[model samples]
Target: MYTIPKTSTTDMEVTSIRLEKELKDRLKKLANNKGYQALIRDILWTYVQQKSGDYQPQLSNSDIRASLPATAQQEERCVLTGKVIRPSEGMLLGLTNNGDMVPLSIDSLED
Candidate 1:
């Protein structure tokens, strides 16, 4: 699932967690225009989706810029077919037009 709907600051609860100074600096650099806290929320949402097996992305074959062969070091779901790519299984990394690299089952290309 995509990130939850955004709400105003008033709708959010205050929570605090400590981060290493170096990591905080790195997050700031990576955050850019989106702001670090928002980025952190997005990351949390993505992690939750993946763990829940609800992380399917809405992509199509035409959306792929290229397909590069690869082997899964860990389980992954093919973006197009939602098929599981078991560890050590040969798969393809579909580079999307938007630059995201996603997993694809080898058989996903057959049809």
Candidate 2:
């Protein structure tokens, strides 16, 4: 295992991030010798990548919340079968000739 010398590195000012209790517990449990700071840095870097469109991180609660389109409370239905499907979840459900309604993720839906 590689070791980083504890010789005091140059200090950088850090702003406080308020992680939820559940997230904190999970991070503390998963952290290794590299520790919580490393994990936090990696997480922030991933978010940066996502913001810059350089990388596609797995969708998170923040991403979903931010991407949500304005909508109203009304039942939506399939034009063919008249089956109720919620638009908030942004599903792509379709029935084949065999009459199987296959549900697809929003990202997979092609324009």
The Cα local distance difference test for each model comes to 0.84, 0.47
Reference-based TM-score, model 2: 0.38
lDDT tens per residue, model 1, 19-47:
99998888889889879888788788877
State how far residue 28 of model 2 sits from its true place (Å). Answer: 1.4
Pairs of residues clashing in candidate 1: none
| Winning model by lDDT | 1
Q: Number of the top candidate by TM-score?
A: 1
Predictions: Cα RMSD each: 2.7, 13.6
Clashing pairs in 2: none
Clashes of each: 0, 0
Q: In model 2, which regions exceed 4 Å deviation? A: 1-11, 56-111
Candidate 1 clash total? Answer: 0
**TM-score of every candidate:** 0.75, 0.38
Q: Give a tens-digit lDDT track for model 2, residues 1-111.
A: 112234343564667889899988888787767688767766676556534545432322222212222232344433233234455655444444444444334443233
Cα misplacement distance, residue 33 of candidate 2 (Å): 1.8
